[model samples]
Target: MTRDGPDNPARPLAGTDLCALADLADPGSKGFRFRQERLMFAGFVVRVGDEVRGYVDSCPHAGWPLAAWDDRYLTREGDLILCGGHAALFRPLDGVCVAGPCADQRLSPWPVAVIDGRVVTT
Candidate 1:
């Protein structure tokens, strides 16, 4: 949610996680947190389909981090990243603002794609 785009060349994520992919077996499910942040990027890995995607943890609503508590990120059918403070729903695919207070505010996705069972965020 900064002044930069998804592919801002900031190396949004350093090392990737494949073991953590199991947490995302359900839709709208997410589990990730950076145990390390070398270049100012807290890596978060999510599983979508058979592929794993990564994004920065910060939510776009009020510059707060996503995940209400624990590893929970709203209900499975929620289909959006629910903000704990103001209840903003952010689309997972493109990180676009979908509903709630910040409907037009996107989650600022970190450019990531699956490559041979690896989730790379660059």
Candidate 2:
């Protein structure tokens, strides 16, 4: 289910701690899942240098999770976000899809921040 709504059980609350910044690579991505009863929230964070961006896991074109495997969000060269299901590419700084069937579409942003070296929902 979509985790954008406040009523979604799987949606993480603000201040939720995800992981330590150092645990993530300089140019890497990591997936996160939260569950409450039968509902589940799937999201990911991409780190590029000191900047980190977060997006909902669902792809706009297919309505499916972007990553085919764990934390495999970016392309091999690590320049753009890659949708494993449809081979769509997106700008990591913003969730704008640049290629594939979902071109011009965008991934939903999940507000997050790094506080005290920890990635936390904001």
Candidate 3:
């Protein structure tokens, strides 16, 4: 048995090391999911230049994974996050819905950190 948050044995627990920051493409997004003892954590990380932000994978409007394709969470122009389920657009810098049915809503934030070139939960 294990608790939620950042202590679980899943791949996303606190101190758990994810891929290197360089593994993610700049100005792009990547999806990740992990489950342990029946608990699941699903999220994505967006990278732009030297900044990276993580958010729960679920969309505010439809409660579905934001990306229809694996690890493809950005718009065609790669400027904002796009919800494939409903075409909702969100600002990658803040995850605030800027257009579509769930306008004004925000994606749940996931604490993360970069240490020695790796991305880890905080």
Candidate 4:
């Protein structure tokens, strides 16, 4: 189910279970990947309060994965998204590029659902 918001949109994720919402620490993020045959899907999830937001792992500036290390998506303060490629910063709540080369661009949204306390693809 898609939450009605400018940041949230309905997306089909090929029926993949990302992780348990409880497994994600508040203000933390996790990366996920789904592959079938030669097709692959990669993204990350950020947990803020009781809400979780999903975004494509790719950086809008260089089309590179934002995290250089596993699940290392946030800045040092854990408030903004950081791109390891070009130091682009994004708003965690909506994946909007706040500062850097990709200013005004956005990370692609990957709609997710909270089902029975688990973060699952919509």
Query: TM-score of each candidate?
Result: 0.65, 0.95, 0.88, 0.85
lDDT accuracy of residue 110 in candidate 2: 91
lDDT of 2 by residue, 4-115 (tens): 5566779899999999999888789999999987788888999999999989889999889989899989999898999888799999989999999988989999999999
lDDT per residue for candidate 3 within 96-120, as digits (tens), equals: 9999999999988887878999988
Segments in model 1 whose C-alpha atoms lie over 4 Å from true places = 1-15, 18-23, 35-40
Better of 1 and 4 by lDDT: 4
Candidate 3 residue runs with Cα over 4 Å from true position: 1-11
Worst 10 residues of 4 by lDDT: 1-10
Could you give candidate 1's per-residue lDDT for residues 1-122 as a string of tens digits?
A: 23334343443344443343444564535544433233334335455466444556677656666777755665456455666767677666666767776777766555565555555544
Clashing pairs in 2: none
Q: Which runs in model 2 stand beyond 4 Å of their true positions?
A: 1-4
Number of the top-ranking candidate, with TM-score as the measure: 2
Order of all candidates by TM-score, from best down to worst?
A: 2, 3, 4, 1
Per-residue lDDT of candidate 4, residues 1-122 (tens digit): 22323333232344568788889988899997655444556779998898899987788788778998999999989999999988899999888999999999999887887899999877
* Candidate-wise lDDT, in order: 0.55, 0.90, 0.84, 0.81
Best by lDDT: 2
Which of candidates 2 and 3 reaches a greater lDDT?
A: 2
